[model samples]
Target: MYCDVTKEQDIGSLVQSTIRLHGRLGIMFCNAGVLSQSMKTILEFDLSSYEKFFAVNVGEVAASIEYAGQAMVKANSRGSIICKASIAAGLASDRNTDYVMSKSLVVALMRCASSQLAPHVIHVKIISPGPVATSALCATLGMGADDIESMFLRMFRLKNDGVLKVKHVADAAVFLATNSANSPMSNKLEGKVAIVTGGASGIGEATARHFAVHGIRMMVIADIQDELGQKVMESIGSHKCSYKHCDVADEEQVKNLVHSTVQNHGRLDIMFSNAGIVSNTTQTILELDFAEFDRIFAVNARGMGACVKHAARAMVELKIRGSIVCTASTSASSGSERFTDYCVSKHALVGLVNRQANSLGCMGLGLKGVTLDTKHIADAVLFLASQDSDLITGHDLVVDAGFLVR
Candidate 1:
């Protein structure tokens, strides 16, 4: 039977009808959502457009959950409610604030419903997709079929593989639905929550995927690259991770990222402040531009500082012995030509880690500060995040293949 989920009566009737026909309600996938065609920024947003987007994206999903959850409770049966969300939920999109906000609200609803319905053994999971070659996506972006292929390649920087297919998302949803209660593998990081900054590509993305593989209950992958971040989320499976667009240079955005993680996941156990940017143009000390220096410090040093501050506060407030890991380069100890500002920014991380370690240690928080490859750094982070490194704090684990020594 077809039903309009936005209509309360339709949702109620659909649930009742399903139960009457099947004798029980086992699984409900609230997957219907809409994206507005108007590419408007926040300042140019129209309230009516925003409402329309939310009505289908957020309102319908919540209504389905309520109606479906009630049916599950009445029947005394275990069930899973999987909501379709987007990687956009976590990231900011240009000229698509309405779509982004609506999807973000969907994620919030899933978290809220998960907690409220846990007593009834109803599992609530959000499947957030990156970019799939769907008709809706093509239509919204006003791209032709050929343009879509090239766009994905350029957006994700894909070589030949790693393009997100619709089947990948379907597989993820099936996994979540089937294993809603218990996972097959014995995950080391099970029941823990984490936040990974710069998680769109390279080291940050690798670390997020590693955390998910280790069985982290939830991960907030924060990055400014929406498409790349979504790709990472898709690869990791949204059952374990979600992407958020965050520019670490912005302190308010960093604070919001941490606050939202804790709000959605209940507590934060690990924070990987791995976002950093280097100066593109090389300049000697005499020729260095103050603006260039400031830009590097903004993200590499100050951004990491903001992340540590908020992560520490959340850990302390919740009485969690959390681990805070920052990315420090070998340049922190050694110097390199044409990278004076980059080296300086990394050195600042070393100092920040040392001081934060001592300060947070007094409050029972762990701070350790990686880079062979992205995976090697991710492994070091995993160790620090796990019980193996519980006694280790205020230390920097450098993974640069002997570059510093050489």
Candidate 2:
């Protein structure tokens, strides 16, 4: 069936036909845009053209979301809804005034729809990507793929190795569409295979069962405790969950654990690296046993790193953009008076998220000034929340300190 996004009836019919064919709506990706627009500045923007552009770009997105969301709700489907936005929505651009404004409105519409649909247990999200060398973009610029890629790299000030691809965006969409990190109340883990380190007991055991209950295809419970791990796996049923003794502190064991998971399941989607250790000796720094500190670091820091490292390796090698979550503690961020070794190790574990430096065209927390300005944003928010931006509807007030100007 030929579907026109601008026609509400067309979108609605598409949704109805989809449900009729699939028996249930599991995920909906709303994508409609006006790509062949004049790259005009705000001052030169034509109101008539702007209205027509929005009808396809923003209005069509709204229509698709409404129809898809209604279909999911009626079918009692707790699925995911995703929309596409661009980095232009967040930054001020020199041209394409109508395109930028439409994206901004699309973002707001997705947020409002998400809020309204939360009660129905449907998850709504957006994927905002930088310049991608899609065919449309290549045609728009009248440049080939290589030329456009080089232009984007220079325009964005990205590193030599950093190249954005449409596949990266699609991978992100696939992850969000099958979000496994949803609330325990939802069965978003459907058809996922997971490896939970330290899954014998405590938080690991609980999460293992929860994943199994939420429709995980396979749950590999890896832990040092053989008997406990076996019990947890059996209780969850051998069909869904299985046990494997893995001392995360040992690199060989971690490597084999991840390898076997992929070998058995064909793919590994979620890696819950929750394995760690606490202090066994005097927790204070003055009396902290050096040997015990080493033990703690072996498990909490080194072991977790090994797990994440191997899992990441497998995922990247297999072209799987999977999720790897390390269960770090509050001590990872804040200093502690006791369990000093434990705190340090947990901080090392958190290096995956917060580091002094980073790679892949992304930098970690670099300057101390950003930390100091945590409280300063409140003043800017107050101004916007007040009468300051009453006239500036649908505008993103960049708080950057003159960086974009340069």
Candidate 3:
């Protein structure tokens, strides 16, 4: 029977009708949702638009869960409750705040329900897909297949295998519903939470994707580029990844990002302060502008310092014994012409890492100052973030394709 999940009465009736027809309900999939066609930034967001999106994206999911839980309990059946969420749920968008917020709510709701319903043999699972080539997404974004593919390639750092399909989601749902054994894939980073700053593109984005493949419990990709960040989050799949807008140069934003990660995920296991920029207008020391020096230091040195400070604070408070990895260039050790400011900033980062390693020693916080296509950097980060590198800290692991050796 058809029913409007947004209406309580309809949900109730639908549940009753399903029970009557099937004698019992074993599986419930709450998949109804909506998104705005026109994009609006946070400043231009319409509250009414948020309300409309939330009614379907969040409200319907909640109602479906309520009614489904009742039906399952009444029948004494062990079943799975699966909800559809989007990559948008985890990523910040320049224009789709409403969609992002609503989708995030769905994940939060399912997490709460999962714990509460576990004892009853009712499994609550959330399926947060990447950019699936669905009619709805196509219509909402006003993009065709070619356009979508091109965008994904340009913005997503991951290898372009193909766009996610509906069948992939369906298969995932089936696996979650039936699987009882602990799969190796699911236990890679079983209970770890990490934050990847500058994760919108390049090495940061690559690290986020790598973590997802290894089964990180959750990852927050923090970057200043909202659009690119969203694409990175979507590319990695929202099931275990999210994006936050953060300018590491802004101490307050860095603090909030770390605190919010801990607040949402209980504990933070890793912090990849990988956001750094090269000077667009390189100049010799004789011609170097103090302003240019300041800008570079703000991000490369001070920004990293802020991230380390906040991440360390969170780790200490939670007694997490987490790892913090900062991105450092070969320039940290060697100087280059026309890159005086950049080299100085990197050297400063090395110093900061050294100091943090000593200061956070009491807290058992490991710090590594380190990259390459980003995949190489990601690999180093994975090791530093894992138990394998617990013995290593306060060192720079440079990846420059033998640039220094040569």
Q: Write candidate 3's Cα lDDT for 129-190 as tens digits.
A: 77766778778788886787678656643211234457667755665566422234534466
Residues 1-406, candidate 2, lDDT per residue (tens digit)? 7988888999899889988887988898886676645878978879999888888988888888888889889989888888998878888989888888888988888778877887787877777767789888888878999998888767763422446777767755765676334423545566767898888987678667767766678989999899999999889998989899999989999999999999999887677777777787547888878888899988988887787678767876776545555566655555678888988887666554344113311321110001111223222222222222221111222323222222
lDDT of each: 0.81, 0.69, 0.80
lDDT of 2 at 123: 72
Candidate 1: segments with Cα more than 4 A from true spot: 1-186, 371-375
Off by over 4 Å in 3: 1-188, 371-375
TM-score of 3: 0.54
The residue-by-residue lDDT of candidate 1 on 235-347, one tens digit each, is 88898899998999999999999999999989999999999997887887877888999999999999999999999999989988888989988878877787788888899
Q: What range of 10 consecutive residues in model 1 has the weakest lDDT sum?
A: 156-165
Give the root-mean-square deviation of each candidate in angstroms. 19.6, 13.2, 20.0
Task: Give the candidates in order of lDDT, highest first.
Answer: 1, 3, 2
Please rank every candidate by TM-score, starting with the best: 1, 3, 2
lDDT of 2: 0.69
As for lDDT, the candidate ahead, 2 or 3, is: 3
